[model samples]
Target: MKKRLLILPLLVITVLLAGCIGDGTKNMEQQTELKGVLKLDGSTTVYPIAKTAAEEFMKLHPAVTIDVQQSSTGEGLVKFLAGETDISDATRAPKDNEYAEAQRKGMKLHMTVISNDAVGIIVHTSNPVSDLTTAQLKAIYFDGTITDWSQLTNGTKKGKINIYNTDPKISGTAELFNTKIAGSADKPYVAGTTIIHPTPKMIPTIKDDPDGLAYTPVNWINNEVKMVKVNGVAPTQKTILDTSYLLSRKMYMITDGAPKGLNREFISYILSGDGQSIVQKEGFIPVT
Candidate 1:
């Protein structure tokens, strides 16, 4: 009877191992057969997060290739509408003009929420200005009221404020900045301000300048720059998730309608719990 019990236990173990091997083999087959290069671009803000995800996805499915680029939100939309890419990552939804343009071109778009982004104004660490009200921000950047750091704070330096911002026409970061800080569409570049392109460029510029104020997606704010408090409220994950941060922006994956193949599968993963964890880890709010 003991020998018979031993044989039964051995059979159970063998069957369990076989099941495990079968599942792994199935996954391998799926990976090997998965094909197609997913071309994606847009929102320099979403670039790092999406690029990281693409790199991770490639590890599991080596047969598939993904290309992520930063061409700003408007350029991405144009590319998506032209069917030049399979995915367009953006910080905002399609504007009325963009939607009309897509319709005119006979393009259909489907949106997938990937994450939430806090549009934050970062200043050089050397600047003493810590907090700003919405009205003050508007006056400084648009109306040219507060021209120097000393006007806003009792800092040692009394130099003119240098503003660095994303491309006004192509970036959602610019759109938010225009709406919240400029309070109008006709904002002239403040004197001593520079408009940076590709959005990511602001990271290094802000780090190098001593009197610069720039706005970007919070995830892109490297340790080199210090985030400023708006109306005495700092930009935090809690504030962003709760919609307390007035400058926060929603991020999305703009596709040429419902996607298929690995593109669809990967997007599904992004909306999954595991994928969202990656977003949170990268300092952005997860859509899940």
Candidate 2:
């Protein structure tokens, strides 16, 4: 009787082990092994989110390699037009010229809205200017005036305003500036100490220096800097989604053509609930 009981226990153990092995094998086989390298490039505004998505997607599909590169929006469009990348992370939709170029090359762009983010005007925490009128912001950055903090208040006892911005040649944020501030392509930047580069660079410099001011996506704003209110309205998720914020934009994922493989899957994942969770945690607003 004892021997029979022992044999029965051994049989149960063997069955359990077999079930585990079968599940493991099935999981391995069910995984769509993405092998070829996928390339993405575009707006620095969209770069961090794209890079994060690529990293997470690659972990599930170990055979896939996603390469994310930073280029300003216009340059990204150029590369996409040249067929250098499979994906383009853009803060703005492709322009008419870009669409014409893609059509000429027999490539169609597949656009997926990733998130809604406000473009925040940031200043060093030390700056007392917590709110700025849109006219003041335009005068400071686009009209080439408002060179000093004192100038912002019409000769108050404030220090000089150190202005920084992303290069208009490469950034969609700059394009926004051109539209909202300059109202013309040939309009010059508001006069101040210009620190022009990518958005990544602009945000950091503004944070580290107490006298500096710059603009970037709200997701990028942290305790390191303070977001200045525009026309008495603050840049926040509530303001952006409600269309109350003046400095806001939509982020997008652009594919060279109809997406396939991990690229398609990854975008789908971002649009899914799981993906939007990451977006919110990362300080960006989910498209949904």
Candidate 3:
């Protein structure tokens, strides 16, 4: 009878231990299953980096879904203000009005500098002019002060300049250009200039036109279009990282407040070494 009682106690203890182990295993599984949807929207210029990082992050956590959208930076800020997105990507810093709007909603906005990018002055490959000063760029795009290639090319070229610009109301690149070159976001582009939407369109638009000129992020510059030197310095990763390039700007990912849970993890991953590698591969200078 004593042996039977001792055996019953041993069985109960074993079952209790097994139950504890099972609970622990389930908890571990729950922790390992990183399941959530991450919504990202913002600058098409910053899209490549966000997309690449999203892709890599998903590989690490299969249950996580990231929906990345390409809209102009201004629109992204609008969505963020509406509490529709978890993250907003921007090629420039948030404007005062953006901060005010977020504050009006009682939401705390946090901006993370993810990368450094340069505003590239692009032209057709055949264009003989290889460089432009900040003054020349400002006059060309802002004041319409320089209207023809002959004015810049010293009579070597004779044609009306075809200036293109991203819509300042929507595009972060245009806002950056306006603020950096023209000294104000309220400043308008030169009259008669064509306004493009996404930054990528600027590449082919300039490539096909012999007299084409536009400003875009340096990553978008390809062999089809030649990127002109600004202030006697080319927009290289080194120059941009060192802040020696005249047209460089910091890229950002803004959250509503201090990132928590998966949002924190995702942003942490992006700032990590692996994520910065993707940044460099995507042709932007890593913040690190």
| Most accurate candidate by TM-score | 3
Error of 3 at 43 (Å): 0.5
What would the per-residue lDDT of candidate 3 be over residues 1-288, giving only the tens digit for each residue? 999999999999999999999999999998888889999999998999999999999999999999999898999989988988999998777788888988889988888888889889999998999999989999998888899999999999889999998887778889878887889888978789998888889998998999989998888888999988988999887888787888889988989888887888888998999999998999888888
Give the alpha carbon lDDT tens digit for every residue of 120-162 in model 1. Answer: 8888887777788898888887778788888877767787788
* lDDT (Cα, 0-100) at 30 in candidate 3: 88
- Using lDDT as the measure, what is the rank order of every candidate, best first? 3, 1, 2
Q: lDDT score, residue 282, model 1?
A: 85
In candidate 2, what are the lDDT values of residues 11-111, reduced to their tens digit?
99999999999999988976645676888898887887877877887887788788999888889989978989888888877888889999999989888
**Candidate 3 Cα misplacement greater than 4 A, ranges:** 1-19
lDDT of 1: 0.82
| C-alpha lDDT score of every prediction, in listed order | 0.82, 0.79, 0.89
Error of 3 at 181 (Å): 1.4
**What residue runs in model 1 are displaced by over 4 Å at the alpha carbon?**
1-33, 154-157
TM-score winner between candidates 1 and 3: 3
Ranking by TM-score: 3, 1, 2
